[model samples]
Target chain A: METNNRINVERVEHKTSEKMKKTNFILTAILLICLPFLLVKNPVWAQKKESSLQLSFLKKADQSKNILLTVKARNEAGKFAPAPNASLSIFIKSNEEWLLIKTLISDLGGKASMKLADDLPMDNEKYFSIMAKIENDSRYEDAEEELRVKESRLTLLLDPTDTNRILTATVTQTGNDGEPMPVQEAEVKFYVERLFGKMPVGEEFVVATDAAGKATYALPKNIPSSDTLGNLTIVAVIENNETFGTVESNASAKWGVPLQWEKDPFPRALWEPRAPPAMILFFAIVFGGIWLTYFFVIFQLIKVHSETKIK
Target chain B: MKTTKTITPLIACSLLLFAFVHQTDVWKAPESAKAKKNPVAITEASMAIGAKLYVKECLSCHGKKGRGDGPKASDIEKPVTDLSIAKTQAQTDGELFWKISEGRKPMPANKKIFSEEQLWQLVNYIRSFDKTIVKSK
Candidate 1:
C-alpha cells in the first residue's frame, strides 16, 4: 500500500510540473510578440521629439559692434516649445582662429539670443559660425544646427508658356529653409549680352517685390539669339550695409522657343508664288492663240467665197 | 466647202480637250467603287485561322483575350499594345495589312511567316471587333 501511495504522489508531482512548464512556454511566446510594442509605448520616448534649428545673420557688421545671434527651435508639432537648459554655442573667426563668442541655455520660448563680438578686423566681407545643440540619450532624437557663410544663391523660374523669354526673376535671401525670406526693400540689377560680335555688358535695372513677395522685370526687346545662350548673372544689392541677408542670386536658361509645326501635304515654298502666275499665263496664251486662228480662218473663208461668187 | 472645213477643225479640237479632262477625272473611280461595294466579310474559317495564328505567336505577348498582359509581357521593358481598343479595331484593312507586314516598333514583322492570304484572313477577323457589324447582323 505504501509503495502504491508513493507512486501516485510521484505521478501527481510529474503532471503538475509538466502543466507549469506548458504555462511558462505560452507566457514566453506572448511576451516575445508584445516586446516591440511595449518599448515603443514607453513615456520617455515620447518626450524627446525631434527639433529643427534655423540660423541667420547680417551681411556686414561694424568691428566694434556685436552681431545679434538668434536661434529658434521647433518641435515635431511645429509649435514653438521652450527647451529650457538646452545648450547653444556661437563661434566666430578672429585672426584665422575659431573663438567661441557666446554660450547660453535656451529661454522659456525655445529661443537663444546672444550678441557676438567681432573678433577680427572688419572688411567689406566677414565670416562667422553658429551652432545649437539639444541633448538626449536616444541616438535618433538629438539635434544640432550649423551655419556657413558662403556665396548667396539665385533661382530663376521662366513661366512655361513664356518659353524663350525670361518673364521674371526672384532674388531671395535664403535661410535655413533654403528659401528666401520676405524683404521690404531689395534691389535686383538685370544684365544682358551685346549682339553682333559686340562686347557683353551689364545693364542695371532695379526691381522690388510687391506685397506678394514677387519681383517682375520685362526682358529687353533685343535679346541676343545664339547657338548657346550663356548664363545670366543677376547681382542683388540691398541698399545700406545689410550683411545678414542674401546679397545676390544668379540663374540662366537656354535661348530658343520650342516650335511645333502642323503637318502639310506640300513643301513650304510650293503654295506661294509659283503655281498661280503660271496657271494664269497658260490659260491666257491658249485663249489668245485660239482667237487668232479663228480670225485667220474666217478671213480666208470670206475671201474664198467672194472669189468663187465673182467666177 | 471652206466654211465646213473650218467648223469641223474647231469641233474636233473642243472634243479632244473635253475627252482628256473627263478621262483624267475618272481614272481611279472604278477601283474605288469596287472596293466600296465589297467590304470585308468575317467568316468562321477566317476567325479560326486568326485564332490559331494568335495562339501560336501573339498569345505569348498579348494575352489569350488580347488584354496585352501575357506571360512574356512581364519581362519586356515596353508594354504590349492592346488591340481591344476601338481605335485599333477601326483601322482600315489596308492599314492593318501594312502594319502587320512591316511590323511596328517592338512588334516583329510577320511578313515572311504569314502569307498574303493569311494576312487578309487576319484582317477579316479584326473587322469582327467592330460593334456596327455585330448590330447589323
Candidate 2:
C-alpha cells in the first residue's frame, strides 16, 4: 500500500510541471506577437518611454497668467516617469517677435512652471502663443511644444437708473470667421479707475458672467471722482481667464461726488519741509557756489596784501 | 458735322500725346545741374551700401531689379518709371541724383530722407542694373 501511494504522488507532480511549461510557452508567444506594434511609436505618446515636453496646464489668474510644463521620460518598465534635471526654455510670441521669457531646470518630478507677468508684451491680435524647449539633453532627444490661446474681450457699460447705477460687462472671443462670439460663464471684475492703479468696485473681487456673456453690478454713490464734473471711469476687467488671458474696457459715468484737490493756502517757501526738493537743491547749489567764489577772492586778496608787506 | 467728327479724333490723339510727353519728356534736368560730377567714388563698398539702401528706401516703388513692378507700384495712378531701360540709364549721374532728390507727385522727395552721399549711392545702385555696367565691368 505504501509503494502504490508513492507512485501516485510522483505522477501528480509530473502533470503539474507539464502544465506550467505550456503556460509559459503561450505567454512568451503572445509577447513576441505584440512586440512590433509596441516598438512602432506615436509621437504624441513617444516619451522613448524616453522624453517629452508636455504643456500640463494653463492658469490665468485675475491679475496674472501662469504656464506649466511637465517634462516626462520612459522608465525601465516602459512607464512614463518625470525627467528630472532637464533644462527648459520658455518663449512668448508677441506679434511677430519670439521673446525669451525664462530659462529653468525641471524639478525632480520633471515639472517646471512659470508665471507670465502682467507687463509681458502682447500684440493687438486675438491670440498669443507660448513655446517650451528642452535641448541637448544627455539622455533624451530634444523636445519642443507650443501652445496658442485665443484672448477674450471684456467691455463695460454704465446705465444710470433712478437711484442705482448699473454697470454691465460683456465677454466675447473671435470665432472662425474672425467675428466676435460670446464667451459664456466667464468671470469678470470691476474696478474704480485710479491714477496709479485700480480699486476693486465691490466687496467681492470677482463676478461671473451669465450665459449671454454679461455680468452686471451696481455702483455705490459715494465713490469720489477726481474731476470736478463727477465723472468716474469705471473699468470692467477679466484677469487670467483661461480663454482671454487679460483684457479690460472702461467707460466714464457722471455718478460720483466731485473731488476738489486742495492746494496749499500758501506756496511752500524754500527750505520748508513741503518745498520741492529740486527747487531747494537748486537754491542751495547757487548760494553755495557764490559764497565759495567770494571766499576764494578774499583769500587771494589777503595773500597779495601779505606779499606787499613782505616786499 | 463731318469736320466735327474729324476734329474729335484729332483732339483725342493730341491729348493722349500731350499726357505721354508731359510724363516722360518734362523731367528735364537743369543744364548746370546735369553737368555736376558725382563725388562718391565707384567701388564695391559703395555698391553694397547702395544695394542695401535701395531695398529699404526705394524698393517699394522702384521694384527689385529696377523693373518698376514693385508691390506698391500699382497704388500710384502715375506709372512707375523703369530704371533698367535706356530711357532712365541715359541720364547722367548728377541728373539722376537731382531727379531722386526732387521726386514728383507719385514719388516723395528723398532730399530730407537721404544724405547727399546716400543719394549718390542710390544713383550708383540704379546704374548697376544697366546693361552697360556689365560691359564696363
Q: Which model scores highest in TM-score?
A: 2
The per-residue C-alpha lDDT of model 1 at residue A8 equals 100
| DockQ of every candidate | 0.01, 0.00
Question: What is the per-residue lDDT of model 1 for residues A222-269, given as tens digits with 9 covering 90 to 100?
Answer: 544443443333223332223333343334544432233457534335
Each candidate's number of clashing pairs is: 6, 5
With a 3 Å backbone cut-off (N, CA, C), the pairs that clash in candidate 2 are A47-A50, A49-A74, A60-A240, A62-A239, A152-A244
Which digits, one per residue and each the tens of the lDDT, describe model 2 over residues B78-121? Answer: 65677877889999998999999998887889999999999999
Q: Please give the range of 10 consecutive residues that has the lowest summed lDDT in model 1 chain B.
A: B25-34
lDDT of 1 by residue, B28-106 (tens): 2233322432243567877889776776777666654454544565455555555655767765566676666667557
TM-score of each: 0.26, 0.32
Model 2, residue B60: distance off in Å is: 51
